[model samples]
Target: MKKAIIVGSAISVIGLMLVSCSSTPEATTTTTRQTTVTAAPPPPAQTTTTTTHMSGSGY
Candidate 1:
């Protein structure tokens, strides 16, 4: 019984060491970027008017 227990314990310790010391694959990371654009406001409206009157002949 004692020998069996010692053997079992040794095997368990070796298994744990192997599992802890093994190398794992590196993880991959992805990055995303976002952009936003805003349009400028239109200029205000403007109006101009001109009038001319002329008198003809003699008065």
Candidate 2:
């Protein structure tokens, strides 16, 4: 009968869908390790100054 044929087709289609959906395994992402670098300290700060004199004051 047409009804039986339709039912059989529907069942077959559902089985095929489930098989296709679960046929392949999921892929996982790989992580790369990270590296850290440390830098050396900077040199100390320095400053110099000079004094000025006027033409003839006892100073």
Q: Which number leads on TM-score?
A: 2
Model 2: per-residue Cα lDDT over 1-59, one tens digit each: 99999999999999999999998878869878899877878777766677786677766
Task: For candidate 2, list the clashing residue pairs, or say none.
Answer: none
Q: Please, what is the whole-model Cα lDDT of each candidate in the order they appear?
A: 0.84, 0.88
Clashes of 1: 0
Best by lDDT: 2
For candidate 1, write residues 1-59 as lDDT tens digits. 99999999999999999988785656669666787888888877776677777868776
Least lDDT summed over 10 consecutive residues: which range in candidate 2?
45-54
Cα error of candidate 2 at position 46, Å: 78
Candidate 2 residue 34 C-alpha distance from true site, Å? 22
Prediction RMSDs, each to the true structure = 16.7, 11.9
